[model samples]
Target: MKSRDYSQLMQELSEAYAHHSPRSAAIHQTAVQYLVDGGSNALRTIEPFPPRIIAARGAYVTDEDQHQILDFWQGHYANLLGHNPEVVTRALSEAFANGFGLQTGFTDLLQVEVAEMLCRQTGAEQVRFTTSGTLATMYAMMLAKAFTGRNLFMKVGGGWHGGHLWGLKGVGYHEGFKEADSAGLPASVMKEVVITQFNNTEQLEKDFHRYGNKLACFIMEPVIGAGGLMPARREYIQRARELSEHYGVILIFDEVISGFRYRAGNVAALYRVQPDLMTLGKAIGGGMPVAAVAGRRELLQLAGSEHGGKVKFQGGTYAAHPAAMIAAKVFLQYLIENETQIYPRLAELGAKTRKVVTHAFEEEGIHVRFAGDRLTDLPGSSLHMLLFPYQEGLELSTPEEVRNPHVCDITLSEKVLQLALLLEDVFIMHGLGCTTLAHTEADLEYLGEACRRVARRIKPYL
Candidate 1:
């Protein structure tokens, strides 16, 4: 078989995309005059400009070009109940109708209500609400450093905790996981953050042995997001817990993407290894911007008034906004009440989509593997990411392997496939993206057919 020409293919796909969505292209062109890179978020800004979405509901988003595109990005994988889920929206509307509003910057009963729900659901002794995953994770790290009196922290390569200071290193694969993700970060701060390989227990143990005494914390995602959406092994998580305990390091689980994803609460519960602190976001807000750092009382109390305000994590002005809190409360209640039905159905749909899409590509003589399933063969994934490995027999177990161009066709999956599918009126991030409860069998069928069409169109490039 001939090698794929990803650059040539991307050029062709970008031309086709611009031709199909002229309005979006024009909107992006206008946006570039103000917004950096024509967007606030870098990931959303793709080649030839991204489609300017005007409205979104259920499993589809309407672009400015009047195209109703089938969406799988699903609000950065936060829309478990789909865009503007009625259960959450109606509750927010009712709150507004009852004279409630947003961002008053005062403590309200709604904050306590949602915080109590989170504590009860996730086995956390305390909870502190924030506005985003970045702030939440940053606060968690600060708490860890303050409590442990250590400076060094450890995170796996390609694990994206957000755009915060502690999260700026070892995130993207483009630099081969060697340099800081951003340009302005201090070298002194970046050096204190030790990097480790995901799911590699031996390397983790070695690092812990070398830097465990000086390390304040070891933060990781149980279901590694951005890195590949791959779940860690049971033993690996168990070992992490054991080592953190022995080394006096605060183990922090960054569950921004995984929390409330596999179940009603945190995915840490599934691993049976509770970290000292867990950062929650994305799905927990019910499509609103709400995030939190919750865990043992002592650590969380560092941010409290009684503790002399060690961490400075009093939260921002939008912390526990009334409407967002109500939305989160209603969404969590619905998820808890329908846990058995919601989770199983999500897993089933995700598995079905993965299998069908893989089959679609295989029919066109294309070989691809997905990185959504658990290493233990567990059937609980609601995310699917297709990867084209360099060889037929190689397994994608780590972030390096998943993002390395020599090991896998990173450009083919991230850029070429993305542009190709957008022309088919389908949107995906990290390949197939996440499955929402609002997605139906018919939607899955549409997605499968779209993949098949995309495969045939791009087959000759390979």
Candidate 2:
């Protein structure tokens, strides 16, 4: 397949949106005022000129202009049960009637219930709640360091844990590491972090040999979520487990994205290798802000417990808020009850979507790839040239290309952009299925139709 002129296509797309709807214009204006200083939280995944979503239901979101869009993004893969699921809403409503926030007693039984369920699911004897994934991982790392009497921790290259300084420092995106994603992280902090290339067992062994004693823990995502949807090989994960046990270094599976979606537990369940600690987020709260660090009781007992007369502190005001707990409990119950049927259905949908998408791209003469476990998958389609567009006289690419390419862009730029716009429009009307428990086979058809529409548009370009 020949490469597309993404520069020219993007130029035309920008012109097409020059006179957007008044609602979209208003949203853009408001966003500029409200978010410009702080910036979008997940800026890399969103479009440069993102539409302001006014409302959402199931798998579709309505923009400020009242245009509905099929939401494959799914709140950065958090909405496993889909937007405003009845179970979540009902739980939230009941919990709100009981109370919103109280600093006093445990008025919520759901929190404990969910934690117990997690323990059963993940094989962790104990669990601690946090408000965000970052906090969960931060606590996990601190606990590992304290328990092991070591300061250094090994992390995988191109993997993202969260925004916490220590966690972010462990990521390979910083200076001195292979690639640093963020700036302002102190150089001193980066030095304590040891990073190894993903999927390379030799490097893992070498790092362990060099710094095994100094390392407090080794943290990684079972499936690389933010770094790219790269699933760790089973053998590599087993090796990590063995090395951690041999070195007395805590093994932490940062399943913030992989938890509950791929299997009931962390990817450890699939590989039959249990880590000392595991961090969970995303679907844990069923779209609410919740995260957790679960591990052996001995490790978790250090929280607020005197270990040789020293106490480890970990607390947050909203750590176990009743509303969030209730939502999580109901969501988890639904998941547990329907595990047999729901998981397989989602897997089937994912497989079907992947197959159809792969075939569509092939037919369109676009180079692309699809990746995911049973529940979800990501398409990394891109124009191979965009990686070095400037080398071929093309200085810029589409807003999405600047962020993430689908697989390849061999089709004509104009046609590809048009197809994207058309797909966005179609998604607005029919409401694409997210492959949630609520979504039927018909919904999958809608999703396929959306893909087919885009495929047809790029046929000529191919």
Best by TM-score, which number? 1
Residue-level lDDT tens digits of model 1 in 1-462: 346676777878888888999999889889999999999998898887999988989999999999989899999999998898899878878888888866676788888989999999999999999999999999999999999999998999999998887899998886567568888888786788899889899999999999999999999999899889889888888999999999999999999999999989999898888999999999999999999999999999998888888789978988898888988888999999999999999999888888788888998888999973436634579888899876877668789888887877877798888889899899999877898988889988888898899899888877
TM-score per prediction, in order, is 0.97, 0.82
The CA lDDT of each predicted structure is: 0.89, 0.64
For each candidate, C-alpha RMSD in Å? 1.4, 6.2
Q: What is the lDDT of residue 46 in candidate 1?
A: 83
Q: Candidate 2, which segments miss by more than 4 Å at Cα?
A: 1-5, 17-22, 37-40, 98-107, 169-177, 308-313, 372-423, 426-435, 438-440, 452-462
Q: Whole-model lDDT for model 2 versus the true structure?
A: 0.64
lDDT of 1: 0.89
Q: List the residue pairs that clash in candidate 1.
A: none
Candidate 2's residue-wise lDDT over 8-97, tens digit each? 545554455544545665566666687753246653212325556778788777877777666655666777766889888877776568
